[model samples]
Target: MTIVLAAAAAALFGCGTFLLLQRQLTRVLVGLALLSHGANLVIILAAGGRGAPTFVGGDEDRALLDPLPQAFVLTAIVITFGVTSFLLALAYRSWLLTGDDEVQDDVEDRLIVTRWSVSEELIDAEEAALAAHAEDVARREMDEEAHR
Candidate 1:
């Protein structure tokens, strides 16, 4: 039924999105595959259910099925398969180069997590305290020189 297909598509899409968020390259690849499948299912459902061939036939009572969607889904499937294979190969290469399939955080992400966690006000206060200490030390050095 259409309802069942819709539910299946939604579930696949949700699962795929969840997997895509993982750090592992393998999981990401799998997620992409699931997402592609969900999209294909939606496309087929949109076209309509299975019926007679789209081409003109002798049977006047038979409903002709639209073939455009089927053709499109087939093409998309082939493309997705090729792309998924390439991505899997890349993930495997990454694992061979390192020991794990998990992707490392980029500099930008690390900076956002670490550098932005410190408050600007706190940093300013710390800098001011250090400057005051430096000035006091310099003043003492000058005083000792004057006494000598």
Candidate 2:
């Protein structure tokens, strides 16, 4: 059959790209289920093989087979089995909250190493102490409008 379904979709995309470059998390959830069964064996070898068997009324000369790639590999295996059960429940809630499953480290590298140096130096010392208390309340309201 198309060279044994193109060598079983190149050995399921080379063992799902070597278990998605393993670091664990159950070999990246078995390399996303072997790259979703090598993209449903390349959408059933682009839908075509084992032909012969389809007839609509008065056997209008048989030879059918194209049930739209078996209904698009049964709706892409029920949406990749609900996205592999939501990526194994977010890798079991990231191994129960960070006991380790790897991943983190890039929310803009933890917002540039733990929030730009202590919240930008306490927001520039509270905007230079509110601009020196607004220039001492505008020089005491221009010395009470030059003494009345």
Candidate 3:
């Protein structure tokens, strides 16, 4: 049973993440919803081992299901619902504004990527300089502490 639930959760999260990486807004919304479903399943699986309901009054020795996970799942469901609705509203607005449902890559991001060319040697030099600066600061701090 645990294995089955784990597999299902994994499938949901995998599908959700795959969908999320697409360029369409609708797919992203659906992906978020799927992710929420995966989270709910995880919460259920973590809620506790199968046992008697927590409401039972007199089964002192019997294991009872914990209620915290249930509460958390419920709250998460409400939050996810709100987020989905907001995303739908945004999609609707975007359609009104641009008549397109697909999201385009940001112009700034593309431009920056095209313009920047950092060599491996440059990165190594920057790291070495930063490390030396950090070491100098540490040494000065230690000297100050010794004097005090």
Per lDDT, the best of the predicted structures is 1
Q: Provide C-alpha RMSD values for all models, in order.
A: 14.3, 16.5, 13.5
lDDT of 3 by residue, 29-142 (tens): 999899999999999898766655776752757667888888999999999999899999998988887798789666445444544686666656666766786898899999
lDDT of 3 at 80: 94
lDDT per residue for candidate 2 within 2-57, as digits (tens), equals 88888988898889888888876778778878888878888877765655564453
Give the per-residue lDDT digits (tens) of candidate 1, residues 31-133: 9999999999999887766566567872767767777888999999999999999998988898897888889766445445554677877656666766786
Candidates in order have lDDT scores of: 0.84, 0.75, 0.83
Q: Per TM-score, what order, best first? A: 3, 1, 2
- Residue 94 lDDT in model 2? 93
TM-score of each: 0.68, 0.40, 0.70
lDDT at residue 27 of model 2 (Cα atoms): 82
Model 2 misplaced stretches (Cα beyond 4 Å): 42-47, 50-62, 66-69, 83-85, 102-148
Residue range with the least summed lDDT across 10 consecutive positions in model 2: 54-63
